[model samples]
Target: MPYLFTCPHCQTRTEVEDEFSGQSGECVVCGRGITLPDFAPGASRPRNQAPGGSAGRRKRPAAWIAAAVVLLLIVGAGLIAIARVGGSAAQRVRQGRERMASIRNLEKIAAALNAYAADHGAYPAPAITDRRGKPLLSWRVLILPYLGEDELYDQFNLSAAWDSDKNQMQMYQTPAVFRHPNSQGWGSETAYHLVIGTGTLFPSTGPLGPKQVADGATKTLLVVEGRGASAWTEPIDIDAGATGGLINAASGVGLGGITDGGVCVVTVDGRGHFLSEATPSMTVNALITPRGGEPLPDDVLD
Candidate 1:
């Protein structure tokens, strides 16, 4: 006994044996799907048989109609699953590449800062302050031109406070160089942190001491990281007192794993290194204060 079937996806008529009913196969025309119900062995033919007696052949049309429906369902489900998986994979790859690009740009910014320092005496001071001695702007605003952000820097009103509620500042729109790509840290606004007066070698504004002479230029850390919620220009603290400057990641020293140059440090030698928590806690602390550290390992250079 043979049956005829149609593919739902392609609307192609197909034929299958009645004995093979309930069996599954791909449709030839649409190549979509197929299955047929099995017939009992020695099944009797219909009573109103014609002279040629082709009951099995007559049943083929109905069988094909059912097969078509099942095929379409399976094909649709498969397509949906593939699309979903592909979309997720593509997103992950894109994020990874973006993070890497941010990191590279930061490296370049670090180099530019070093060059600025070599020409000038100290790290650029926070933007000039108001008569009340309040800092009017961030230090980054001053170094914009040197970092190839000349156009952005020139647009800012040097005399105004960075957080001024006055006219909207364009500098805010330009991405700051300090924020790391991987840092999806909290706060809507965050940027790189400069450790001013934290370096022991880079002593506070005071007469140069022997310690400052030895480590100030070479041993002090120039930059670290902080949360976006924090004032990006403010030095980060290890403890509530903020007396401890160096936060180590391994020792969980300040705010846990923020020391040990855990804030990325770029030395005068133009080398960049991730300070380890394993490094001496005292060494990390000494490095942050003005005029207090030992020489860092040579390898920690850029």
Candidate 2:
């Protein structure tokens, strides 16, 4: 049972349960002090009790207080849950921004490569060399000047061989542009990977006649990702083959092998697209023998 009480200080009225009669509380409406007298509900009044006659009532049940406490705890828990979820969302967005920046850097590198190619006839063979004409370093090594890392590029001892005891393949990390910020530490003998094929339409390993084309050069990938890895940055012994444009293994470097012929390839066009998945069996066989032509079924393209 509940009883109404009037606050003498501010003349405010408040309702309190019978059990809380001895407790004092502040008036919500007038900021005045209020005190309750214990009273029982529907009980006979004692002769000693003054005017109201019914002062003794059963006290408020304890169950109501417990329910209130549970409600408060539930609300507090909900707030904490919301805060954690918001924090995670923010982290994901930040990572996404970093990834975008890395991709853009790759785009700029591709453009530079194109400009270099335009100046020269074909993609400059992997690297520049001396009278012996052996590759002194990877093409990625040569592109440093064009990518605005002239000082860093000069630091490399071009005369030294890759993975030799002296250099230990440090040249592979020269180009900052070669690595994506999102890459969790994967790279190569060279900062960049190279795509090789007879400069022809639908390129096949055999002689490039006037009529061959590197398949999907525009749609295929040239290089999508490079972080850091065991493969030397220079043309490292992989046979030049037509692999959906990008030289990145059909999968990705350091990420594990990409079997789907198409890794996410960033094209000379400065656009990025996922290339068709190359059949794993076909790609593996191609890696061993560059000349084998099990032309991917047209369906594979679809």
Best by lDDT: 1
RMSD of 2: 11.8
- TM-score, prediction 1: 0.53
Candidate 2 worst ten-residue window by lDDT: 204-213
Q: Compared with the true structure, what per-residue lDDT tens digits does model 2 show for residues 1-302?
A: 44555557665444444455565555444545555555655433333333344346454543433332344456768988999999999987875665556556657766766666666644445555657866555666666677887776667677766555545546545455665554456554323354444542113322221112234334333444433453544544223343343333435432113222233335545554443434453442332222344355443322
lDDT of each residue in 37-110, candidate 1, tens digit only: 45554443344222233355433444454454456466767888998998988877875564445445546666
Question: Lowest lDDT 10-mer window, candidate 1?
Answer: 252-261
lDDT of each: 0.51, 0.48
